[model samples]
Target: MRKYPIGIQDFEKIRKENFLYIDKTQSIYNLIASGNYYFLSRPRRFGKSLLLSTIKEIFSGNRELFKDLWIYNQWNWEQKHPVIHLRLSKLDYQKLGLYEALSIEIGILAKEQGVELESKHLKGRFEELIRKASANGKVVILIDEYDKPITDYLDDLGKVEENRSIFKSFYSVLKDSDPYIRLLLITGVSRFPKVSIFSDLNNLNDITIHRKYATIAGITQQELERDFADEIAEIQQHQPDFLGKLKSWYNGYAWHEEAERVYNPFSLLKYMDGRDFRNYWFHTGTPTWLVNIMKQNREYDLENVHIGENALSSFNVEHIAVIPVLFQTGYLTIKGYNSNNRLYKLGYPNTEVRESLTDALLSAYRNVFPGNDSMSVTDDLSESLKKNDMPQMIKALDVLLSTIPYDHWKAESESIFHIIVHLSFKRLGFDVRSEVHSATGRCDVLVFTDRYIFALELKLNSSANVALDQIFEKGYLRPYQMDARKKIAIGINFSSEKRNVQDYLVKELE
Candidate 1:
């Protein structure tokens, strides 16, 4: 049996070589039937390229590959049309400057179809191809990774604008060529089009948050069990805890309002191949341009990333701005959406994403938390909680905080503390949150469990008495007093000049 199409994105390559194809043909049928112009935003390595390649196959009229798939059974293969397949990712996104890159891609498409037209740039050549493709009849246009170039220059506004304008002109041709086009499917990770690249194409439909097509790209757990069932057993037997490990490391993506979650298909299969589940997804694919977003917004909480009473609808990209980047480049995702509220809440989709994010964070910071450090923090935490050794936890926290790498510490101290403590508790398998706000005021750290909720207030230089006074005066404990389970308020002060605790006050609410 052929290996699954783990990284292969070409439909022709996968089918011609007889690779295992995840039958996402049904989604293709629905997508095509629903609209003539559609766009989808999904994370990196979630099979957007493969999906586009499959579309290319359908339009190229390659009927053999579809024979057993759902679309083959359903689509009228006889009605296939000429296709204009433009995959932007195949070109060098970084090296080829914008004008040059788009021009080359246009040349490639023309060359592929034997449409030899000499044009200086994309607009003129693109016009010629659409005109030629239309002479025979309307054509199917599939553009893959449409925003890769713009994402490459996000740090520089001028370059981003320049590329966006170039893309806008290039894609605007599609609108003029629309009457002669049978269908259009544009694939990327975001729907926010800041440059107005697709402004001329008003009929475009964005299925980025559409629940029905949620499983269209990623590997659903059900698909994993059905198609790669034996592989799971193979790994599980070698390590009794493998299934749990796999789930912890590679599962949990919530793209659909209805579907539970999914794993990064690319990472899962790669791990299955090597019998080692690691951060494969981060290794390849577009470098996290989202890091720019995180860096720009330096104080974002790492803990509340995937957990809250409700999903995070706090962010949205401007359609003409670099919005398409996050959607196409694959950092943020449409997790749960509320049509009534017209909101899209985004977060990590699976275990692969979370672990990969942790690794990426460390890499981005270029510093690893000492393994022994986490143990020391835990031991100190236990001493503070169980033995009322507040000074010990405070002193340890000061040392940890002071030793923080310059890159991570460059962020706000609050943000740094949140990242550090959250990473620590994440290793301990507890849900942690920083900056917990109540109606009256906010607590610094809050850890919730089935039996207890710990409300903590940290003061780096303030007196312990002042910290304790604020807890009561601000009514931090009042909010949790009504809970049946216990709630504890901790007031700790750190030495302004050293890695030792100045004082501490701990209290329990009735």
Candidate 2:
């Protein structure tokens, strides 16, 4: 069996060490041929660094590394260009600051090319390097994680703005030195607005959502089947449903409306290594600041988060919003796109994200670390729901709610309880919808399982019977009556004083 390159981002190292590599050289060929300046935004650990490194190797005329790769014969080996590759993620901006890091990186690039800079500023040094490097041949500028410096300081707005100013000035050199550049490519986790990073470089083509390049940074199903045929065969021998389960857990990322689905390369590789399905991608780096921002803003209702094509690409960290940040960071993905309306519906990509993100939100809302407490409770709740054990389900949820810290009960609205119940069901891999509309009125929560349909109504400072009465009075279960699955109505009341479930009731609808 060949070694899987889990953390190896260097193209030459992978080729030299004989690590398992997926062929993405065709995409690189198309990328260079299609545009001079390009920008691609993808989630972290989705192989952006590897993509950049591969591009560097191609531009630097490393033909030996592409021994059996697709672009070996097609690429012009004679046309060698000076490659100035800078990976911002390698620097700790929190310690050195953006200006210092930028200066040090640019200085190193200059020292490599034996070029001298007239000015000490980052902008001047960058411009001077491009001019000198391109004097012989046009310079191929490759930047990886361009937004890392700015995103690192998301919590500190003053520092973030300062870094943005430095980036704006530094990157403006790309536009100014366009004549001296052969190809400029930037890859990052998020794409900020023009006023933020690419204000001057308006001509930079953003192929993030382009159908052709959608699979550039991810592993498509075809690539998986083609590259890991042996592994798949072995897994199928041991686990018959391995492929189906694998697809459910980590696949289904679509950039365009009709684009083919792609899997998270990091998680897929990790799963392949151990044959254990886990939230490898989400655990890599939880968006703590992103979750905190959503919690602080009280943006709990995320089921209907919609954005037009324009708004989806508009990401500004300074004025942080939930939709753009979550979508860009891989917490949510494109579910559906309405061509007529030009609006995109966003949701969690797969079970890993759907379960893990809700768990993160649960932790943030309760102001408690998500140890085994919540997980155990959700597990018990799911089993109870499966067996039609209403009392056990209620007990599990009430116990879980009681664990929330008293001081965390700051919200007086009923949405808090609604959101908690919704998240709990969602975390357990149950289909849950909050504020779902019915003919009579909107239901507080609707849960769907293979054998049961649960309609729940939650009341804050009222009797459980009152909530139950409202469920029947409002005809909340009417829509599910015609379905073949068993229908159940549940009511729960919460007390702000106790910071736990006050009472609960459940009824089966005939």
**Per-model TM values vs. the true structure:** 0.82, 0.96
Give the least accurate 10-residue stretch of model 1, judged by summed lDDT.
306-315
lDDT, candidates in the order shown: 0.66, 0.85
Give candidate 1's root-mean-square deviation (CA, Å). Answer: 4.7
Worst 10 residues of 2 by lDDT: 369-378
| 189-283 per-residue lDDT for model 1 (tens digits) | 55445227887888888766567887888777777787787787776676878767777677766566676566678888787788776668766
lDDT of 1: 0.66
Which residue pairs in candidate 2 have backbone atoms (N, alpha carbon, C) closer than 3 angstroms, thus clashing? Answer: none
